[model samples]
Target chain A: MEYQRYNCGNCGACVAVCPQQILKLNENQVTKDPGCDECGNCTIVCPLGAFTWKVGHEV
Target chain B: MKYDVVVVGGRIGGSIASLYASKDDADVLMIEKRQEIGTPVQCAEGTTQSIFKILDMKPDKRYINAEIDGATIHAPDGRAIDLAEVSCENFLDGTGYKGYILDRKVFDKHLAIQAAKAGAEIMMKTTVKDLIRKDGRVCGVVAEHLGETMEIKADVVIAADGVESNMARQAGLTNPNKPGNIGSCAQYELFGLDIDPHQLNFYFGREIAPGGYLWMFPKGEDTVNVGLGVRSTKKTAYQYLNQFISRFKGTTPVELNIGGVPLSGPIDKTYTDGLLVVGDAAGHVDPVTGGGIHIAAFCGKTAGQVAAEAVKKENTSESVLKRYDEIWREKFGKNLEISLKYRNAADKLTDKDMNALAEFLEKNKIENLSKISAIKFLGKHPHLLMLIRDLL
Candidate 1:
């Protein structure tokens, strides 16, 4: 998955609400856990709509 | 790029900070990572009129959705108490106290525009990658703007970067929130709502919200912002919001927002060498009410003024900038401390205690009480007093 590099405000609202606890924020970039499932919870919670799933990428 | 002040985050706090700094003749830049200033609204969009007075801003119809005359609190068992009369007496100079539900998108954008007009540069879609520290003092920021990495230098950096502030950590300040200190929230703007247009409604119960309350604030004639906040719950805020929205069978949400609020007091430290933290990043919110817009504006203005003075004096050291903390704390710290005590005590209250408190409000015919007043009233009861003795 490719997150919007410029749009993540680093608010960590996405990290806090992620059900699987797979999203980790390093400064402004969010890294997904290897055990991630694409539940889209992070996307739903990000205030800036910063997260996006790259096509053909499977978690 | 170089500026005297670089304010990260372009919402209310950052914009306001930039506005004051620019007005003080400091070169200022406000950066926001979002494409828009206030898209994907995160709050219930409710605030008191006192905020406008603090900012010396006149109320604009363009961003006001509704003027709330009073509020009604619903007990878990459906008992209701209206607060109109007492609220009027205490807050409104004997006229009715009116809270406002704002169109946050418009309101935030307006504040940013005000900052820009005051000579502050605003850069949207700019994400601060990290703070640029020189000899353990923050001197600038590395940010990504338009897919390009740019290093922006500043004499002072203000972190208005919302709830999860990387700047705070970069400055070596402890996190402002603890596990139970934050409340998860989800809000929905619904149309075709059948409810009182002038009174905000709050519902309290463990089942409804484990450690917080749910609210429905009227937006316009037939619309409302319905939301809930909860802390230390097994259920997600979304689940609680879903269950709460199920009550309004016919109403459909026009907008959905999920966010978090710091329910603790302000952070112990809000200023570091060459850096200042304001607004949600500083946890300048009411613990009991989960309100921060006013506090954010208040602290933002203070930080900006202090930052400008420091810049002019060539003393942006932590010792000099610490005045922002002292001034804000002297102004509003006691209230926040009291709110924290009350929140901690109230969160421990049982469902039975809540029912009893509701009963007391009903039986005593108390129309409204401030958080402190409510705590005092509850303190009068031996049982309730014992429950919250440590807080008292």
Candidate 2:
């Protein structure tokens, strides 16, 4: 999934639905570690549409 | 650092758990990732009076914005069903004060203060990075605060974490919530919106919120919380909220809040060995209404009582902690299950169905809801009969 960080609300919606648990939420920013299986759970749960299915952005 | 219990998150669940656990004389520590207990509020702040009953506290105006006695539900065809005109027999949850709109920013911190007064230690701005496990059983947590990492040991760890909870996942009590089961929501606190200050308004239609609905909750003094939730949709909930907000002129948002609510029923398991899960972490939220404050308070109290008992017994094993699950389930399990069923059935409703139901209910107001009138209404809206049957 491609993350539009600027649009992120830091609501932690992505962190809860991330099956791999790779997402981490900070006070002001949300970060992701490597090893995303790309289940696209974050894409649908985000209130701001921060995460998107980009197919192969940089894989 | 070591304590009898370490509760993650400092919202309704965590603070209540901390308060009850401390009241029972168990050494407790509650951790919060945010510096403040409640800010950037997520909820529409509507909660039943049952929560105050559960907390054994009076409704203090410092945190309560408005007291609502009724609600107005708007259908797709512009029909309105005023719940005040209906009798108690029509309500699914039975008769009581409808609800209260809370200033969560004040309420959350007040609850945390109550926990502190009850002897629970609180650590702010600390995030638990991982759980501390020993011998295949969860024991405590490794947390970070201001770049300092520390491992806090506790006999039992209560995961009162919110929607973004990972402690339960790490302990193997549950998995991530499916997107379909989550209510992706956005709210705006508007400064100048004129409406009934004592009544709640709900708008339902696919165009308003595809999988969910929109709510306009009056927060006293010309302020209101307008929000919506949707699921599995390409358009974000924020966009849906903006479309609905655009209708009211001369209104500007003062604060924008975003959140995700787990609409699934409680998780398969709430406790495993030394760990207990409560609140949104355990999916204690009611699916039909997206409300969890009362459920969280009840479960938090139960978990705290159980945790204290386990500590006194000198055993914090799964066998001892499982009592928490039994107690909360016995109180709310069947209700949540029924609500989830209703939510699933309601998800299938179309604009025509909603308008038909609204029209039917409005005609069957308290004075007109006779036996023959009900039969005639059903005869006219036969499809609604099927829908209600499916819900049941």
Candidate 3:
């Protein structure tokens, strides 16, 4: 299955809805700094479809 | 005055719902009980790096607490399984969002701001009293603002209240949670203990959390969020949580946090005439993991988008709202269902089983525990594997 990635130019749109605060923008690029727990909020919150994961990957 | 949509709760679900509706040019009003967003954080605040792609946004360093390089899994018997492998290539070099720990207060307020920027009106310190139905159909909501009763009419209403969603029940949707389907959690934010910044830990077994688990997510140098969750069955969740919290006696003294997690899947039905329920209020938490943040937002976005479509169609009936259900099933319901099935199987696992599972992890490089990997691992144990296979 095709994975999800947004042509996001480092806009902080997905970061806004993160309950875990995992998604981060560093050096004007989107990054997940250190404290990620795979809550998936960032993926669902992004307006540009920038956050994507393999459907059958490990949870 | 009537609006296109009225969202109760200004949290992620509510805010995202408003954003979706307003994006379609629908007038949306979001109400929050708190003066500020994301205060008194109720979650473990850990999320995968890839979640940002789904939201089309990224967080900054300001909200991040640490970078997790790997996770350590401890079985009921205290055996450990540690994995530092990053499945995503280039993820470690910062080319991709690695993963994050966050400050929810700033994060939640930011979501509210984004919703407003998307043209949704937000009201803080506003509480919904009840759902207004006309002819067995939802038409609006009755709310209290600063002790004053006010009636607001909307073409559609979205319920995003976390757990214990009174609004959903008042709207006539069947309650989806029972004691067996809920998990209670208690945690402490300790500041004095030196913790490994790159390692996250999960301890499991009936002794620590029957049908649940315990976790340690380090925030920074000498700080970590230590907590435990126990399934709410015959034991009252409060009783179990209090006893569990006291176990941190020799560790250190710090802030204490308590909350409940709905392990049941969403209600069989999540829509009614002119109304839709999203997030925890709809019981969309992950059954196996007790994580609801992503599922809730995904539900919220779908609800918001579908509600917008209903407004545009000029049909706010139960049938129209049912479309949201279809959208959710297409996107998240299947995975959630699978997770719940896994949870049921996990619930049947004994402390001995947990010890064996932990030892297995320590022995093998199943690396990260994915649903498929877990199933494959249990394949050798015919009885347990068969049970899980049937459930899955």
List CA RMSD, all candidates. 5.6, 2.1, 14.4
DockQ of each: 0.14, 0.75, 0.02
Enumerate the chain B TM-scores of all models: 0.93, 0.96, 0.87
TM-score of each: 0.86, 0.96, 0.77
DockQ-derived CAPRI band for the predicted complex in model 1? incorrect
Against the unseen true structure, what C-alpha lDDT does each candidate score?
A: 0.81, 0.90, 0.70
- Residue range with the least summed lDDT across 10 consecutive positions in model 2 chain B: B88-97
Question: With candidate 1 superimposed using the best TM-score fit, by how many Å does residue B307's alpha carbon deviate from the native?
Answer: 0.9
Q: Compose the digit string of candidate 3's lDDT tens values, residues B1-392.
A: 57899999877788888888898889999988666777556677776664455567776776778877677778878787664432334332232435677666677777788889999998887767688889999899988777788889999999987765656777768543454565656566876656678677888877676768888888877678877667533343334545555655556646655555667787888999999998877887778777776667777888899999999999989888898898878877887888788888888888877776666666555455477766677876666666656784
Q: How far out, in Å, is residue A46 in model 1? A: 10
lDDT per residue as tens, model 2, B221-337: 879999999988889999999989898899999999999999998999999988999999999999988989889999999999999889999899999999999999999999999
Q: After superposition, how far is residue B392 of candidate 2 from its true place, in Å?
A: 3.8
- Candidate No. with top TM-score: 2
- Model 3 share of native interface contacts: 0.00
Best candidate, lDDT: 2
Candidate 3: which stretches are off by over 4 Å?
A: A1-59, B84-98, B233-254, B366-386
